[model samples]
Each structure stands twice: as structure tokens, then as C-alpha cells.
Target: MTLQANAGQLLVHRVASEVAKDCFALATTFRGPGAYARGDQLVRAALSICSNIAEACGRGTIPEFRQFLRYARGSAHELRAQVRIAREYDPARALHCRTLESRTTLVIKLLTRLHDRPPPDR
Candidate 1:
């Protein structure tokens, strides 16, 4: 509820939004059947990362929030793997995938810092 925590949330939300946009762009850009399968997986993992972060931020306890952040981080890792496979199927998407990987790395760092913050009551 403090201004500081609110600012942190806004930052995370913005970063997450960026990641989601990248996912959508990459999914819609890459086309063949093989690319389709990998893209689908990538999109889902990307979406999960945002959803999990939202859930964590809204939770009632720090432990609950940390747990969800962990889930979100895991999703980021999953997306990394999926993007690698997607690149194999559609080499043209390599640049986008690399961009996504960089974004995901940033998200992971944000999540770690967010997780380490003191409980809201403190």
C-alpha cells in the first residue's frame, strides 16, 4: 500500500507487459506447422509469467507472493527453452527470440529483487 511498493509493482507490471507483447509478436510472426507448435508453447509460458506475477503481488502473505514469483520465474525459464526450439524450427525468428531472452532475464532479476523485499507490514 505504500508508494514505494506501488512503484515497484508498476515497474514489474511494465516489464511483464513488454514480455507479453514480445510473445505475441513472435507467435504471430513465425508460421509453419513446426514453428506453430513451438510458438504456442512459448506464448503460453510468456503469458504464465505475467499471470503468476500478478497473482503473487495480490496475495495476502509474503510467502504466498514469493511462491508465485518463483512460479513466474520458472515460466520465464520455460519460455527460454521454448524459444530455443522455436529458433531451430524458424531460424528467421532468432533475433526476436534473443530479444525475448534478454527481456526474460530482466524479468527474472526483477522478480528476485521483488521476492527479497520485506513484507508489506514492515
Candidate 2:
């Protein structure tokens, strides 16, 4: 892969990883009454974003890569929604939720840009 592609891939991976970590941390803050289910959904959505991005990088064709980027973007949106819910569910963690939401937005923007741009030769 070209250096530029490699750099872009690394950036996405790093940001996705951060989102996953944040989600996992946020999930732990849930307490009492449907906490487990809500936390699990948040974690799953966050992991999906990372997984989709990784899958996109491994795909042989640009089309496949773009498709996966779309999936990742969708997952990021899902995570954003979850973050909002969590913020409302636990006002004590509002700051963390806002931070996570911002990061998720960043991931969405990054994935969208990657999906729209012409792919480097694979």
C-alpha cells in the first residue's frame, strides 16, 4: 500500500479503537435496571465500527472497501445514538458521553470521506 493509504488506514484504526475503548468504559458506568442490555448494545455497536473498518482495509476491491466504510459509518451513527441515550440515562456521566459522541462523529466524518474519495490502487 502507498504511504498515504497506510497513514489513512492507521488513523481510522486508531480512532475506531479509541471509540471502542470509550464505549466499553461508558458501558461499565451503567447501574441497575436494564443496564446489562444497554451496555451490551453500546459495546457491540462500537466494536462493529472497528470491525467494519478493518474488514474494509482487507477487502480486495475498492467497491468492497467503500461498502464496509458505509457499514462503519452506520455503526458510528448507532453509537452516537447510544451515547445520547446514555447521557440522558445517567446524567452523572454526561461529560464522558459527550466526549464519546464527539469521537464517534469524528469517526463518521473520517469514514464518509474515505468512502467518497477515489481509492488508491490496491
Candidate 3:
């Protein structure tokens, strides 16, 4: 498949993508069946941030987009908490959590900016 520049140009997209990648890496660190559920939750939350942003953009309305951005931001916050819990459960993954936290922060800040601003003219 081909990649496009338009979507990549958004700061939210870039940051969210990074967070998702980090989360995927962290998920693989999960050991045993008991830890699988927790890892799955972290993966879902990370992916939700990326999916919500894209879904928001697809809604074709500024208000809808802003609303979705808020959803994405909420997901980011959730991921942050999940990361902290993961760190507590497994200290070895603390570094991964730190990186994910930083990327998630960037996504939240960009989403806040998009939500507050008027839609750009087509």
C-alpha cells in the first residue's frame, strides 16, 4: 500500500502513531497468560487514540472532529494510567512507559489545539 503525506502532516497523527508503536512494543513484553489481558488493554487504548483521531477527521464537520479529538485525548489519558500500572506490575518496562507517556502528552496537546481552533477553509 502507498502512504500519503496529507495525513502525516498532522502533529496529532504523528504523535499518536508513535504512541501506538511504543504500546505495541510494550505489549510484547507481557509474560504468561495472566499478563496477556493487561497487555491487550494497553494495546487497545493506544490504538484507540490513533483511530479516534482519524475517525474525527472523517466526520466532515468541525464540531464532530473536535468531539472526536476530545475522545482521542481521553483515550490518551487512559493510556497514561495504564502505562503507570504496567510499570508498577513490571519495573523492566518503565522505560517504555516513559516514552509512551511523552508521546501521548504530545497527542493530547495537539488535539487540544485542534479542538479549540476553527476548522481550516477547504
Candidate 4:
């Protein structure tokens, strides 16, 4: 693999890692009834983003990689939706949720770009 491709992959991985960490931190803030279920779903969505990216990198074909990237983007969107719901459910934590939502948006944009780009020469 070329240095450029490696660097791009690393960047995506780093961003996804940060998202996961932030999601975990956010999940810990959940409280009251139904909190556990909501937090678990949020955490799962966040982890899915990272896992899909990793799976994409592992795939042999560019099409497979792009497909996985799409999956990752979908997870990011799901996480963003959960963040929005959390914001409404816990107004006290709205600011934190907003921040996480922004991060998820960034991840979505990054994944979309990666998916839309032309396949690198084999």
C-alpha cells in the first residue's frame, strides 16, 4: 500500500476511535428509567462505525471497502440520531450531546468522501 492510502486509513481509524471513546463517555452519563437501553444502543452504534471501517480496510476489493464505508456512515447517522434523542431526554446533558452529534456528522462526511472517491489502482 502507498503512503497516501495508509495515511488516509489511519486518519479514518483515528477519527472512528475518538468517536467510540466519546460515545462511551456519553453513555456513562445516562440515568433514570430506560437509560440503560438507550445508552447501550448508542454505544453499539458508535462501535459499529469503527468496526465497519476496520472491516472495510480488511476487505480485498475496493467495492467491498466502499460498501463497508457506507455501512459505517449509516452507523454514524444512527449515532447522531441517538445523540439528538439523548439531548431531548436529558436537557442537562444537551451540550455534550450536541458535541457528540457534531463529531458523528464529521465521521459521516469523512466516510461519504471515502466511499465516493474512485478506487485506487490495484
lDDT of 4 by residue, 40-77 (tens): 99999999998888878777577778888889888989
The Cα RMSD in angstroms, rounded to one decimal, for candidate 1 relative to the true structure is 2.9
Clashing pairs for model 2 are none
Candidates by TM-score, descending order: 2, 4, 3, 1
Question: Highest lDDT, which number?
Answer: 2
Question: If both were scored by lDDT, which would come out higher, candidate 2 or candidate 3?
Answer: 2
Error of 1 at 106 (Å): 0.7
TM-score comparison, 1 vs 3, better candidate:
3
- Give me the overall lDDT of model 1: 0.77
Ten residues in a row with the worst lDDT in model 3? 1-10
Candidate 1 Cα misplacement greater than 4 A, ranges:
1-8
Tens-place lDDT digits, model 2, residues 5-109: 442356777998988998888888899899999999999999999888888877767787888889989999999998999999899999999988998888888
Candidate 3: regions farther than 4 A off: 1-6
TM-score of 3: 0.87
lDDT of 3 by residue, 1-122 (tens): 12222346677888888888888889888886578888889999988988888887677777777788889989989998998888888888788777777777877888888788835746
lDDT of 1 by residue, 1-122 (tens): 32123423557657977888888888887776666776678789988988887777667667777898899889988887877777777788788878878888888888788888734643
TM-scores, one per candidate: 0.84, 0.91, 0.87, 0.89
Per-model C-alpha lDDT, please?
A: 0.77, 0.84, 0.80, 0.83
